[model samples]
Structures are given as C-alpha cells and as structure tokens.
Target chain A: MSKQGSASALMAEQSPGPLVAFENVSKIYGKGDAEVRALNGVNLQINAGEFVAVMGPSGSGKSTAMNILGCLDKPTSGRYLFKGVDVGGLASDQLAMLRRHFLGFVFQGFNLLARTTALENLELPLIYQRIEKARRRAMALEALETVGLADRADHTPAELSGGQQQRVAIARAIVTKPSLLLADEPTGNLDSARSHEIMQLLTRLNRERGLTVVLVTHEDDIAAYAGRRLDFRDGRIVRETRNTGKPSHAQ
Target chain B: MLSNTLLMALREIQRNVLRSGLTVLGIIIGVAAVIVIVTLGAGTTRQVGSEISKMGSNMITLVPGGDMRMGGASGAAPPFLAADVEALRRELVGVSAIAPYAQRMDQVIVGNENRRVNIVGTVAEISVVRNWKVTDGRLFTLSEERSGKAVCIIGATIRKEMMAGMEPLGATVRVGKLSCEVIGVLEPKGQAMFGGDQDATVVLPIRTYQRRIVGNDRIAQILISGADSADLSDLKLQITQVMRERRNIAAGERSNFSVIDMTEVAGVMQTTIGVMTTFLSAIAGVSLLVGGIGIMNIMLVSVTERTREIGIRLAIGATEREVMLQFLVEAAMLSAGGGLLGITLGLIGAASIAPAINVPFVFQTSTVVQAFLFSAAVGVIFGFMPARRAARLNPIEALRHE
Candidate 1:
C-alpha cells in the first residue's frame, strides 16, 4: 500500500529482537490451472545474533522463506522488512546493493568460479564492492583464515575436496563482512563428519561475531546446531522451537 | 568497476582460447579483404591517373571513327586527311597547335643491328603540343617540316639499343627502304600505365612520311592542343561540330570522325575505377558482416556456457549492467583484436604485391581507421544480443541451472 510501516510494526518486530521480519508474506508460482502457492501469509521474526535454522521437507516453503530473507526473491504480497526498512519495494539494483553492503550467501553446492583459485573466489564479492585490490586480498585471506582454509587459498575448487571447497565458498560469502549470512542447505552435499565441521564453523561465526545466521536445512541434526528453529509445512510455519538440544558447544 | 569487468572479459576469452580464435577469424578475413582490395584499387587508380597525364593533357586527338576509345579504325571509316586537319585549325575556336599524324611499324638497320620500331609521322607542332623534349639535338624546324627532309627523332629505347656506344645524333639509321638521319634523341619515358614501353618509338615529319613511307596524303590521326585558357571538353565538342560541318554530314546524322579529349577520358576512367573499387570493397564488406555474425554466435555460446558463473556474479552483488558490460567488452576485444590483425595482414599483402606489379603501395590511413571502427561496431552490434541474454537472466533460475 506504500504506507510507512507503522511504529507498532517496529515494536512488534523488536519484541523478538528482530533483525529480519516477514509479515503475512506470500509467494505464488505458475498461473491459472497450474498455479501453486509456495508460501502463504507467513509471519516470522528473527532477532539480532540469532542463528535460526529453517527446517522443512521439499515444497514446504522453507526455501522460499529463506529466499525472501536473503532478498533474493520478492513476496507476492505483504511487507518484509530488514532492520525495520521495507525491502519489498526496493528495485533489483537496490536489492543488489543491499546484498553488497549487508548480506552474504552460502549455497548447497560450492559455487566458487571453476577456473579461479580459492583466494580469487573469495575475492569475487569484494570486486563487486569495488574495494581496492590490496585490501581485498587482505580481507579475503582473513576470511580464509576464519574458515581455517588459509593454506588452501591457491587451490581451485576442482583441486580441493568437497569439504575444503565448501569452506572456500563460506570464505567467499563472509569476505565482505556482511551482517546477515544466508546459508541455503550449506551442509546438504557433505558427509556427516564434514557436515558437523561446517556446522561448527557456522556456530563459531554466529557466536563470536554476533553475525545473524539464517540457515535452511532438512536435517534435524543440522537444525539442532541453531539456537532457534522454525519448521515449515505446506507453505506455512507449523511450529517454532527454542532449541533444548546440545548447546552448539555454547560458544 | 570497469577494469574489473575488462579483466573478467579477458579471462573468459583466455579460458576458451580455441573458440575465441575461431570467432575472431571471420573479422580478420573480412577486414583484411576490405583493406587489401581498397588499398590496391586506390594504387591502381593513382597509377591510371599518372599514366593518362603522362600521355598528355589539354590535348585532343581526332580519330577517323565514331568511337574514340577504340585504338584501331572502325571498319575503314575514311582516315583523316590533311585538308580536314587544316579545316580543324581554321574553324575550331580554341585551337592553339595542331599536328597531322600517321604511324607504322618499320624495320630499322644500323651497323648490322636490326630492330623493329614504331615510327610516328607528325609536324613540328608535336614538339610544342606533346611536350617532346629533345635531349641530344634540336627538333626539326617548320622549314625542315615543309622541305620533306628525311630527318627523324629517336626515343631512348632505340638510342640505347641500336646505337649503343656511338653518338645517336647525326647518325643515319635505315628505315624500311630509305635512309634517314637521327636529328634528335628524345628524353627517356618509362613504361605506360596499361603496360607498354613508351620510349621505344620514333617521330618524323608528316610530309616526309606521306611522300616516302606510306606513299599517300591520308592522315590516320590529328592531334590538337587547346589554348592555355581553353576548356578542353568545350573545345572537343566545338571540334566535333566543325568537323561534322566540314565533312558535310547532315544534321542528326552521326559524324564519321571522333574527337577524343584526353582530360575527359581521364575523368571517365577515374570515375569508372572509383566505382569498381567501391563495388569490390562492398563485396569484401559482406565477409565483415559474416564475421559479426560469428562474434554473435560465439558470444551466445559463451553466455550459455557461463550461465552458472553469471548467476554467481549476480548473487554476489553484481548489477546486471556490470554483467552485460563484461560480455560486451569481451566481444569488443575479440573484434578489435581481429581488426588489428586484419590491418597488419592487409598492409603486408599490399607491400609485398605492389612492387611485384610495379605500383606504389598506397596505404590510406582513413581506410585503416574506418575498418578498425567497423570491426568494433560489429562487436557492439553482434555482442548486444548475447549480453542482453546474460543480463536479463533471473539470478535464482540461473543459479539453479545445472
């Protein structure tokens, strides 16, 4: 409706200490006889520094919800706000700028450029930010160190193993120091042992830097690593659980 | 940001080295063809102009035929007579000097060395009209022209070949059956534009030729020079009309003689060669268009091949404009690189071939720059489709593409 989001909306969002809030958001796909609702009037809020795991079976709108949170997709209807600023009406370029300054993404597959070295892959996002080369290299190296892959910076993704490649992808994601790291099934392609290693790394990032983490995973064990969980079923959040599982090593 | 995009484009081109080379090949051949054809055409055109001017300008030749360009008589249409030459001198408005001309092939013998030479018979006016400079001795005077003396002027080819170490002037060389003294040695003139030795000829008084050699008063050609201030084309038309009147041809009837203006001939030849050159250049441009299509094809393939890479760049916060610019730069580089190669090839080919045919290698700088610009244009025009395709791709769907 182009109205300024009411101050009550701010208070309501802040009640959950929200860094990200989705209000009655919906996403529909296809048209007419083939129409399918991906998400329907979903309302949710995740506060600052919260590592929230989104768990749902396929077609349950968990991916769609995560997509909207990352500013990668727009809702068909309703207001989605990031830090109390409406993002639903922002242009595509504005969304890109938002992602450049405030967001990072990690994918299920390590999507680092195939021909580039791991260090160059990590420097990719910084290139878009127009950061100077020397400083971008330093930032990339620091991100690699945080992921414990500093020694593997020169190796290509094809040259590295799956776990090492995923680490490189994570390094690339956080190289720009984004406040909210959106991870879509980050451990989906890894074995359990490597999955736990990646989960530990994500938990460390969330705990130490207070980086807001929104992770999508179908695995319950992967969900357990988060401080909170929002479970989806048939385009709606069916349950919210404040985790009582092992404390993700309780930073 | 621009530098980043340029580097990215370069990296992509380097990654697909074979495809890039194949893509640029069309531009190379296209641009090279255009340059080489146009450069050589220009050189030939210059050569033609210089050749025509060498023969003489502001001079008109009256041939005894309806067509002036045909070298030979058109089926015996009555060769020009001395009376017609006199009438031309008296009736034509801008006539400055006129010569009655006849020519034949003769066997000349001197000191047991025999050579066949072209013998031209004309008046003393030839000296003034044709710019015939005598290097050794003086041209025959008007008295000697009327006296029917067996005096001749020899060109450089015969002076060097037959006389060799002897002084050619004042030496008598037997022509046909009569002995004639070489009174003057003409200056050396190089080969003609259409390919003949211009210096291997002889000139003698027309009266002597008519009385002794051909045994007739019939003139085969009449050469006239217009006054310094006269327009040669207007003079030519006036001569044509006067000749028609003198020949007693009826109105609307075709005149039997043709007045050939050298300047007009030069202009027509220039225009014809210019059109031919442009036509050939246009044919060569087709290949450049094909080269552009080649760029488009390779760019499209490149876009599809790098779909995931594009998605990754977009997801990492690259604007669509940046992505499009990257691909555009790549295309421009390919075509521009090909353009440079083509120019090099064209110049090299011209430089090597020009001397073999004895024409100057004329490199038109504007042509080179134009070809380069055209190739760059091809890149931009052809590269846009693929670039737009890449730019318009949805980030999510592109990332999801396998």
Candidate 2:
C-alpha cells in the first residue's frame, strides 16, 4: 500500500494536469475592422497548489487571460475546466458560485474598503457567504492571524501602513478559505520593503496551506518568487520558467 | 441579512458624512414642506368648520343686494334697515330669533386708553342668534334697544386691550362720537370662524347706533337663528321672500337682498380649503422631484467613484444582486434619514406657529407616514438607474478604471 502511494505521488508530481486546464481560448473586443483580438488560441494548464506568475507588457492580454481564469470574464471561444468542470457551459450565477467557493482576489491598490476596519474588510467575503456574525468574526480574526494582522483588526486601511493594508487585503482574500488566490500586481503600490513583506505573506499562504496563487507583476524579482512564470508578448505566451523557489528571500 | 446591509450602508454614509448631508438636504426641505403645509391646511380647515359652527348652528345671514362675497359688502344699493329685520322675524316661519347688526371700525376710548375696535350696533337677541355669551355683565335690555339707550357690551378683546386690569361694567367708554355705558363684556372667542378676531367687538343697541353714532337706519346685516328642527335652506328662502316683499322688489326682478345660509358658507369654505391644500401640496411635491434628482445625481457620482471597489466585490464573488443592494440601501438610508429629520422639523414648526396664528395644531399620523414613505420611494425610484448602471458594468473595465 505504501509503495503504491509513493508511485502515485511521483506520478502526480510528474503530471499535475487535472486541476485546471484551458484549451484554445480566444477573446476579442469590438467587431469588424475595429476588432482587437486580446487572446488568440492560448493554451495553458495550472494545477492545484501551483504558485504561478504571469508577466507581460502593456496591452499584451495577460490581464485578459487572468480575467478568464478567475471567471470574471468569458472567452469568445474556449474550454476552461476547473476540477474538470467546463467553464464555457456554466451560467453567470454558477460562475459566481465557483468564485465564491474556490477563488480569492487581491489588487495592487490593496482595495481594502478605505473607511472600514481591517476586521470588517476581512469579514466581507464571509458576509457574502451569509455566515452568521459570531462564526464570521471568528473566521475573519483567524484569517487576520494568518496574515500577521490580528493586532491591526480595528485599524482602518487609511490608518495602516501600505504593507499592513495589503496584509489586510490578503486576510480578506483568504477569509473564505478559498483554494485559489488571484492577485493582480499585489505589491504595485508599495516600496521595496513593503513589497517584499507582501510577497512573503503570499508565499506563506501558498506554501503553508497549499493555496494556489496566480500573481501578475512587471518586476522580475517579484515574479521570481513564484514557482512558475509565464511571460507574455503581444497576445501569446512567449516563454515559461520554472524556478527552484524563493523560500530564502521570502522568509 | 438586511440589517447587515443597512449597517454597511450607514457606515458608508457616516464615512462621507458631509457629502451625505448635502445630498439629503433637498429631501429634508421637501419632506418638511409637505408635512408642515398639510398640517397647517388641516388645522385651518378644522378652524373654519368650528368657526362656522360657532356662528351657531342653523344660522343664516341676510346681506343687502346679494352683493356680499368673500369679504365685506360695500353697498351700491341700500343697507338693511331695522324694519327689514323685524319683518323677517314677524313673517318668516321656523325662525327662532332675529338680530340686526351694523359694524363700524372705530377707536373706542376707555379713560385715556384707546384702541381700534369693531363697534357693532345690534339688538339684545344678538347673543342667542350668534351663540355669543356675555361673560361679565348683561346684554342691553330690550327697552334699551327700543329706547335707543347709550349702553354697550364689550367683547373680550376690547376688554383685554382697553380695560385689562379693571372691571368694565357700568364703566362709560367713549365709543365713536358717543359715550356708552359698559353693560356687559363677552366671552373670549379666540378667533372668528372666517379668520379674524371674534373678540374684538363692542356691541350697542341698533337704535342707539342710528340715533347717536351713524344718525341713519342703515344696518349692515341681520342674523337669524333657525329653530332646532327647521330646514335652514327653507327658512332662508322664507326670509328672502319676506325681505323682498318688504323691500318692494318686483316679482320678476332678482331679489335685492341675499339670504346666505351658514351651511352653504361652510361648504364653500371646505371646498376652497380643500383646493388650497391640494394646490399647496402639489407645489410642495415639486420639491420632492428636485430632491429625487439630487439623490440620483449623488448616487451616480457614488457609483462612478466606487467603480473599482465594485469591481473588486464582483471579482471576489459578489453577485450583481449584492452590488445593487448596497447602492440601493445607501439611497434608502439617505432619503429615509431626511424624512425622519423633516418630520421632526415639521412637527416643531406646526406646534409653535399654529398657536401664534391662532389656528389649531393638528398632528396627522397618515400624512407623516405617507410623506416618509413617499420620500423613501423617491429614493428607490431615482436611485435604481444609477445602481443598475453600477451593477451592469463590465468587471474588467471597472477594475481598470483609474
């Protein structure tokens, strides 16, 4: 039984293909002569618990692809499968259900509601989930603890440091205990130290709880923290790099 | 769930306290205007009803030449004579009593104190015909009415203005050009049924008025109180006929005299007030439109300002329904808050101002409730378009907004 388990583990590491798969995706904006094809015939696969970084220049359609991956937008033509369930066939509300249960998002701006306390910000996703107040508070506090922000629960975004605000945003993202975290330039607004701190937080969330993270960034060092990097040019992935990992700097 | 949303809405309003206040100012004024105007109109209507009743039920007034309209009559023909009053009393059926009165706005002097008063020359039956009570002393005797004695009954207002600290009975007051003995003082009727001081009167015998002051038999009008079971309209007709015959109007000619029924007067008053209330409320309701526009403008701005926040919510699993609810809840809180504030302001305004104007202060729960609900509906109706716009935005584009 132990030998069979070891064999299957090695097979899983060799081919981690079942979690998410995108086949021949395309996204077009406008029509006819004015049409802009954002993504054309893009193929990609991201397994569960993979920390992937997407890097591209302005107007390169990396954002479009991320939008599709997060179920925030639909492709003009594609088959997107999460856990082998087809995204193209899912309705809006079903996509919402998928997002509610499986996905969390962080923004470069820290997008913590400006006047709200960190705890309130963290409780937001749970509020949508309709969890009762006591349990929601408990879970929000726990998420804050995970992001090293339990002491700053009562502090508003405006009152916190940029790194703390992003920490609160991360806490908000994880409060629902989602399997996948989508971050768009999560440290884009911060200094080097704050950016490093934010990266470390995301790294810990990914490694410790096995949360899948897909981040978009322009900075090479920031992209280097991911286990895998997909570089884009024009609307196509031009190169891919698998890193040995950044545990030393992340810690 | 609703409470949570409401709390969130309130937090947003509190966060932008100044902006929220400015946004709802129009709503507050609009709502307060509605409540105050409706309340004052209702009080005025009530006052008119009671005033008509206080003229004594089943009452009719005989005005000369049918020319008296909303205001006092300035005669083109001739005034009603003492004989016309007598003839109505003698010839008309279902008449309980009759009194003829003439009015002169003049300065009455008691010692060195002088004030303008409505000097009325009427018979002793004036009290019965008008439901007037002489509080301090007796009304002029019938012998005084016949003999044209220089005696007068002061109304409560004249007493208060002229003789506030003194007993007025047997005190001689210089009324117009004659000195009349104060035989009585009338009970205080705060305001007349129409809209003036009912208490600002000094009554003397009609004969004394003609013999001493005006030196003519031209009385202003005659008041007739109908018996309890009498049809006042029929009695009015009877009085009109007798007055026409006595005044010698030809059979085909329109009667030179007008017999005015109190009931008809009351009905006209009611209709006029009803129309006035509706007109005023309609004007006030225009402010609500302005208020709704204000709400919509603010909400549109809010949606635009929070576009990225909305995108964040949408991207993190918030349904369009949830987005719409947040904005809608914000709007409702704004208008409902304004409504509550407006109601308090209106009640305070009505309470303090009505008494000073000598009208009733009537609190109507229905109007208050209706105004409040209407304001909230205004929020919903106007807030919906902006909220829908916010909800329908493409999340990718919204997130991309700077």
Candidate 3:
C-alpha cells in the first residue's frame, strides 16, 4: 500500500494542468445500518478561465460537490487537487489560503450583512486579507464599479433592491481578484428578468476578466447559459455536454 | 490587526446601542459605588489624622475605665486626684508636664445673651501640653491657679456667643450665675476627631471650678506629656505603675483607669477606617461582578445574532483569534467606560459630603487607578467565554443560519 501511494504521489508530481481536479471522490454520512453517501466516486476537472455549470436534482449532491470544490468542506475519502496541491492533505489554514487566493463564493441568498453599507460589505473580503484601509476601500470601490453598482455604494443592504443586493455580494466576492468564482444558485432568488441580468453580469466577468466560473443550478434554462454543463444522479456525474446551441442575444 | 478588531467592536456597539448600554449599567453602578465608598473612607481617615496631630503627638489621655465601657460614667472608684498626677510626674522617667482637668456643661451668660457650653477647669500646664494657641490675651496664670481665682479662657464659639459685639479679652462671663473674668480667647479648633464641637469650650482653674462651679475638688480626666527624648514604651510603663500605686491597686487586679497613647489611638483609627473602606468596596465590587456577567450575557447574544457575520468574516479569511479579539475588545470598552464614569461620580460624592461632616477631603490616586484597572479586568474575564464561543463556531453552519 505504501509503495502504491508513493508511485501515485510521483504521478501527481508529474502532471499539473488542471486548476481543480477530483478523482473518484466520495462523501458518506453515517454508517452501517443507516448510511447516506452524498458523493460517489465523482471524477471532474476544471481548467483555468473555463465557465462550467453543475445541474442536478435536490438529492444529487451537486451542493456537496460545490462545497468540496470551494474548499469549505473536506471530502470523506478521495484525491482532490487544487492548483497542483493535494487539497485532502492540507490543513485548515492552508485551505483558508486556497479560498482566499483562488476562490470567491457568491451565494443565492444575497448574503449581504444587515445594517452594513454596500461599501463596507464589499470591503469584507479585503479585511480578511489584512490589506490597509486605503487599498481595501479603493479595491472595493473598483469592484462596485465593475458590477455597475457604484452609485449605490453607500446604501445599506436593506436600501437596495434584490438585484442590487446580489450585485453587492458579487462585488464582495470579486474584490480580492480571486482565480475562481463559485456561484451557488446565483439567480435563484431573483425574478426572471433580474436573474438574466445577474447571469449576464457573471458571464461578462468570466469572459472579460478570464475568471473561472462554476455555477450550480437545477433549472435547465439557467444551465443552458454555461459553456459546458455536467449532470449528476445519485451522487455521480452521469452526463457532460457542451452548449453548441444558438445563443440568445436578449439583453 | 488589533486596531481592526477595535474598529469592528466599536461598530458592533454602535449597531446595538440600547442593548450594549443596558448590559454595561451593572458595571457602572459597581465601579461608582467602589469609588464613592473608598474616597469617603480615605477622606475620613485623613481628617481624623490631622485633628489628632493638631492636638500634639506627645499628649497621652487617661480614660476613666480600662477599655470596658464605651462612654464616661461615674463609677464606684474615686475620681483621679492631684496626687496621682504628682506620682506620675515624679516616677515616670520621661516626665514633661501634666494637667488635671474636670468638665461640666452649663449655660454661660454675658448680659442678655446666654449659650450652653462645656466648662473645662484645668491646671496651668494645659496650655503647653494640649497645644492650645491663644488668639488674644493669655491662658490662666499660675498665680490664679494657686490662689483659686475666678479667671477663665474662652474658646472661639463661646467668644462669639458671649462677647458678640464686645471685646472678649478681659470681659466678664457668668458661668451658672458666678461671674468669671475672661483672660484669653482660644483660636478656632474647628471640630474634634470624636464628633464634638472643640470651639465651644470655656477653661478655668481646676481649683476655681471645684470651689465656685461644680463644688467638687475631684478631677474627671488627666493629660500627660512625654519628654521628647524618652522612649514611649518606658514612659507608658512608668506612668502605669505610678498611677496604680497612687490609686492603691493590688497585684493581679486590673486598674480602674486606663492610660492611652495618642499615637496608638491614631493607629487604631486608621485600621478601623481601612477595614470599613474595604468592606464597603467589596460590596460595591459585587456590582462589578454583575457587570461582568452582563457583558458575558450580551456577548453571548451578540454571537448568536451575528453568526452569519462571523461566517462571512471567516470565509473572507479572518482567523479565529481575530474573531475572539473583536468581541473581547467590545467588552473591554464597555467596562472601561463605566469605570471612568464611576470614579468621577465617586470623587464628586466624597467631596460633596466631606465638608458637611467636618472631615478633610482627600483623593487617593492609587485607589482610583485600582478601581479603573479592576473594572477593565472584569470585562476581559467575563468577555472571554462568549468570544471563544463565537470564534469556535462552524463557518458552514453559521452561513446557513437565518
């Protein structure tokens, strides 16, 4: 077993192309008489600057896969590599560094802190980076401008509309200029028109800024926007498809 | 990092203004009570020390009982006599001056104006032993004491009452209908350490008092002075033995009279006031403990209320230490602010009452600093558990929380 592990370690040291790669990863909750495996031997690879979508039913473990990919949770047993580094063996602090340097997460709930202004919300990520006040403010403002929400920078979450609040969350996520942008049901809480607007903003960021995007959603209409789509069933990716259909130019 | 924590703490406090204010009220009361009690106690001690010092450190008083009763009362034993004074002076190695005094409260009349005052009849040596400074004229002469003449020295209060518009020196004041010529006016002594008006006194010769005032030759109290070069313990022993022999007391039996050193009395007063202040401060310190608990409770609530915020900070890359420090800083600010206010109010309270009660006001820098530091400590200690709880929360769970 030790010889095999060393041989595989040598193989891992030899190949380093994907930004994030998962090989036969599985996560199970409970054991024996009552067991629930959330992920089952999933294999996937996400390259830099690629926009991918994960589509599945409620119990298909898409969220679990997203959590593992975002470095928020560890897989039960598997080999996961983030930027050529073995993620499963990394410490909590190392995982935090990965999250800070490589990944930015935008949740569906428009998770802007209550009673905090839009500018302060955007500055939250840089605060963790220990950036100085002047630099943090400037970066937050630039992110706000990128999201076309600079005019509402001083308004609080309560004062902004659903779309505007989501924009602030996006600004907060992107302010650190992370390599990967993870959006979990990014347009789940918005109306159809607002959802399209938010999706367009994400697409623009991914195309223009060369930021890798991983979007999780159950809706087919939302899944069609991604350049590539992966379908999951019973905790395993059952299908992969490229979006070769005609593009809708409705702004 | 510390400044960031402090800013976050300030913002959190500002966000929940009423909740934070209510939580810190306990500390405010606790710190305030401690300051007021300690300040007043120190002021009282200072006032007592200065009053005793003014009466001359070398003076020793002979009370009627051997620490038995609280106040002076007529006992079965005869009063202290002039022979006991003479024996003490002769046998004691550190002999200075001795003055035998007797007192009675009676109305003194100067024409139509009459006022009640303590009439003290003492020997000629009282002037030197008691350090009684004369404002005008002079104390009773030795000749007047020897001849039992009706001559008296009046205090500031008596002079004000009897000689309101007239010159008190060489004026005549009647004590219980017997006219005695005032030979001197004593300077203002303010108040006595034991709660009596020291300025409301009229002094006359012991012989004159026995013959004309109370019609008794017995002395109520004796005042002795120790020589500047003599050891206090040796003088006390010698005086004790001499007084015992003069009173004819046998071996093994406790003496009827007690000789108390003024310095010893001052020491006892200092200890009593010190203990009282500590006890009051302890009671006040309970409020600080309650204040600490309040801080803990509010911090706990704050953690629960800001769980999502904590998760966001964690996701953004804040370490657990940073989260813990933020909450701790908030607690410290509340407690320190309360402590500062308490010290100010306490000083004000002490200063306001010191003059009314005739105690010299004093401010102790050490006590003020101690109270402030203690208040801050309360915040840190009580604030720790809540901060730890906030830091240890699961980021995933907290993010999912509504």
Candidate 4:
C-alpha cells in the first residue's frame, strides 16, 4: 500500500502540466524608425513547483517578459499559455480573469497599499474575485499565517520593516492560491542579509506549498537560490542553466 | 465590485484630502446660490401677493379722463365727476361700494411740526373698500362729507411724523393753509404692492378736499369694491360694461378711462416676477456649468495622479468598467455631498436675508431636491471623460509610469 501511494504521488507530481509557457513571444513598442523591441522572440516553459529566476541587465527585456508572464500585459505576437490555456488572444477582461485565477505578482518595492493593513492588502485579490467578506478575512488570515505575518496582519505597510513588508506582499500574492507566482526584483530594495532571508522564504514556499515561482532580477546572488536560471541580453535569452548544487544556505 | 471600487475611491480621496475638498467646493457654492436665489425670489413674490391680497382681492380703481379741466391747466382732462361714481354704484350688479377720491401731495403743518405728506380725499366707505382699518377715533359721517366739513383721518405714519409724542386723534392739521380736524388715526399698513407708502398719508372727505384744498368740486379717481360672493371675472365684465355704457363708447374702440382690477394686476405682477425668477435662475445655472467644468478638471488631475494605481488594479483583475465606476462614483459622491451641503446653506442664507429685506421666506422641498439631483447629474456629465480615460489606461504602460 505504501509503495502504491509513493508511485501515485510521483504520477501526480509528473501529471501537472507546465504552469507557464511562452511560445515565440515578441513585444514591439513602436513602428519603423521609432521602433523598439521590448521582447524579441522569447520561448520558455516553467514546470509546476519549479523555482526559476530570470536575470538580465537594464534594457534586456526581463521586465517585459515578467509583465507578459504575470498577465499584466499581452504579447505583441506569439502564444502565452498559462496552465495550458492560450492567453495571447484573451481580451483585457479575460486577461484580468486569468491573472485573478492563476497568476500572482510581487514587486521589488513591496508595492503594498501605503495606508492599508497587511490583512487588507492580502484580501485585495479576493475582493477582485468577489469573495464574501467573512470568508475573505479567514483566507487572508490563513495566507498571513503561511507567510508568518499573522501577528503583524493589522500593521500597515509603513509600520513594517523592509523584510516584513515584503512578507506581507508575498502573503497578498499567494492569498488567492494562484498556480504561478511572478516576482520582479523582489529584494532589489533590501540589504544583502534581508535579500537572503527573503530568498530563503521563497525557497520554503516553493518546497512546502509547491508554488511555481518565476523571479526577475539583475543580481547573480539572487538567481543562485533558484533551481533553474534564464539569462537575457538585448531582448533575447542568451543562456539557460540548471543549478545542480544545493542553495547557498541549504549547504 | 462596486463596493471594492468605492473602497478604492475612498482611499484615494483620503490620500488627497485638500484637492478633493476644493473640488467639492465649486459644486457646493453653485448649488447653494441656485437654492438661495430661487427661494428668495419665491418669497418676495409671495410677500407681494399677500400684500396685494390684503388690499382686497375684488378691488378696482377708475382713473379720470376727458375735459372740464379743474385748476386751469389748458384743456387738460378733468377730475371724475360724482355722476360716474353714482352710475358705477347703481348700474353694476357685482359692485359692492364706490368711493370717489382726490389726492394732493402737500406740506402738512401741525403746530410746531411740519412735513410733506400725501393727503387723500374720499368718503368714509373708501376705508372699507381699500381694507384700511381705523386704529383710533371715528371715520367722518355722511353729513360731514356732504357739507365739505374739515374732518379727516390720518395714517399712523403721518400721525407719528407730525404729532410724534402727542396723540393724533382730534388733532387739527393744516394742509395748504386749511385746518382739518383728525377724526381717526389709521393703522399701520406698511408698503403697498406697487412700492407706494400706504401708511404715510392723510384722508379727508372728498368735498372738503375739493372745496378747501384744490378749490374744485370734482373727483380725481373712483375706488370700486366688488361683492365678496361674486366671481372676479364676472365682476370685471359687469364693471366694464357699466363704464362703457356710461361713457357711450362705440364697439372696437378702447375705453377712454382705464379700469384696473386689483386681482388681475396682482396676477400680472406674479407672472412677471415668475418669469424674472426663471430668467435669473437660468443665469445662476451658468454657475453649475462652471462647477461641472471644475469637476472635470479635478477628475482629470486625479486620473493622471492615480494612473499607476489604476494599472496595479487592472493587473490584479479590475476591469475597465470597475475603474470607470470607481472614478465615476468618486465624482458623483463629491457633487452629491456638495449639493446636500449647498442646499442646507442656501436655505439658511435665504431664510436669514428674506425677512430683513421684507420678503417672505419660502422653503420649497422640490427645489432643494432638484438642486441636489442637478449636482449629481453635473458630476456624472463632467466626470465621464476623465473616468473613461482612467478606464482605458493600458495596464503595462501605467505600471511602467514612474
């Protein structure tokens, strides 16, 4: 019976499709002489439960890619399939629905609503889902507990430290139980020690909750924490690597 | 969705308190001004109507015309004769009373005090027809009127002015070097509907005024009072017929003397004031347009300021309709709040000023409610453009905005 359960768990893990897939996506900014290619012919696939980091210098299209993956923006061309659904042809409302149902975004600045408490920020996605108040509060508290921010749920973003605020932002991102998480320069504003702590938290969420994280960053040290890396330059992916070593703190 | 939008709007307004307050002020003043002006105008009309009503709804005035000139002003129309008054009283079925009156403005001297006062000459029945009450003493007798005796009735204003500390009853006052004994002191009537000082006058018997002051034996004008039970339109027709026949006027020709009905005059005045109020309110409505423009301007700024926030919301699954509704609700709330406050302030302002200017204060519930609704409509009309712009914002571009 134990052998059968192990085999079924392995199958369950393998059965879940790629959480996010980009098929020859290209985003062009303007026409002819004023033309700028924000994302030029990008193709990538991220499996469920994988923690992937996208690293690129300025003007390298990493931000543009992150925006498209997060369903914040539509690609100028090519298909973006989020959880096997073609997202390229989706209307603005449909895109929003996709984002609401399957995607969660975290920004580097924490991007917490300045005056709102951590609990309210966490409930924002549920508000979009039109969830009832009592249920939303319970879900928000559960998410806060997941992020170890339950005690500080009532505190506003302004009252929180940089690490605590980012945790609240993470709680907000995951409160909806989205299939994919997109973090753009999540620890760019934090010091090295704080950045390491945030990376550790992301690793824990990836391992325990089995959340698929696609983090965009410029830092090499930040990318080292991820199990897979895609590096970009001049709006195109230049390299891809699998990190076979244990994460820096894991050693 | 609406509640979420409302929450976002409230948060935005709270974040920028001063700008929101300023935006609402424009609508507030506009609505308040409209309410105050409309209320005050209505109050003034009511006050005028009531004053005219006090002078008797069935009263009519007949002015003099034609030859037999008195006091020798070369071929000028003479004063109305007693025959005209007699014909009106006898022939007209709806006629209740006739009082032939002659008026002269002259300096009246009562011992040490002297002042210019309007002196009216008419029979004692004039007081009843004109709705004038005698506060003290008695009206002149018919014998006194026939004999051209010097008995007179003085108004409260004239009595106050000429006799000051002394009681005016039985006091003798000289008008144009003729002494007349005051038989009664008329009550204070205040300003007439036509802006005349009704209280600042002296009344004497018609014969006495003609014989002693003007040195003529003719009436200046005839005051006609209709029966209380008679319809005013029917009475007017009857009076017109009697006067036309009395003067032998041909068909299609206008009557030489004008017969003015107090009720008709009052109606005309009310219609005129009503039109004026409408015109003034239309002009005041221009302020609402200005207020609408102000709202649009502020909303435009708000949209620009919150473009990033809008992007964030859009990215998080807020639809264009949600964003549009958010800003639209904010604008509507601003104008509606302003309108509510404006109506309250306007009523207070109108009520405070109406009595001081001798105008009746009227609080029209419909007008107040209409003003409030108008302000809400203004918000909607003006807020649409900015809200549309906000809703149409590209999430990616907006998020990228610094």
- Specify the highest-DockQ model's number: 1
**Residues B1-402, model 2: lDDT tens digits:** 678889989998998999998998888888888888889889988888888888888888877765645435456767877777777767888878898878888888988888887888888887888888988888887788899998999888888877878888989999878998998989898866546787888888999988888788888778889999999878877886787777788888877667788878888888898899889989988988999999999999999999988887787777788789889989988999988988899888888888877789999999999999998998899999998998888888888888
Query: What lDDT does the true structure give each of the candidates?
Result: 0.86, 0.84, 0.83, 0.83
All candidates' TM-scores?
0.89, 0.89, 0.93, 0.86
The CAPRI-style docking tier of model 3 reads acceptable
Say which docking band candidate 2 falls in.
medium
User: Can you tell me the CAPRI class of model 1?
Assistant: medium
Candidate 3 TM-score to native:
0.93
Better of 2 and 3 by TM-score: 3
Model 1 agreement with the true structure over B1-402: per-residue lDDT tens digits: 788878887888888888888899989998888888888888888887777666666888888888766344556688877788778778888767898878888888888889888888898788667777889988888887888899999999998988899999889988888789999998987877767777888888988888888898888888888889998878988888888887789999988888888777877887898898899989989999999999999899889988999888888888788889888999998898899999999889888888777677898999999999999989999999999999988888888889
Q: Which 10-residue window of candidate 1 chain B scores lowest in summed lDDT? A: B67-76
Instruction: List model 4 lDDT by residue over B1-402, tens digit each.
Output: 677777777777777788877887878888888898899889878987888778766887776443222222222444568788778777878667789877879888888888788888899888778787898998889899889898889888887777888877778888887898888999898876546788888888888888888887777677888888877677768777887787778989866665677777777878888898888888878888888899899999988977877877787777788789889999887788788988999999998998777788998989998999999999999999999999999887887676
DockQ of 1: 0.65
Query: Candidate 4: misplaced stretches above 4 Å?
Result: A1-15, A28-43, A115-120, A134-161, A233-238, B65-75, B106-115, B135-140, B157-187, B194-197, B228-254
lDDT of 3 by residue, B287-389 (tens): 8898899889988998998899888777766667778888888889878877888888878887888788777678889998998898889989999999899
TM-score of the second chain for every model: 0.92, 0.91, 0.95, 0.89
User: Model 4 chain A, poorest ten-residue lDDT window?
Assistant: A1-10
Alpha carbon deviation, residue A152, candidate 2 (Å): 1.1
- Interface RMSD for candidate number 2? 1.1
Candidates 2 and 3: which is better by DockQ?
A: 2
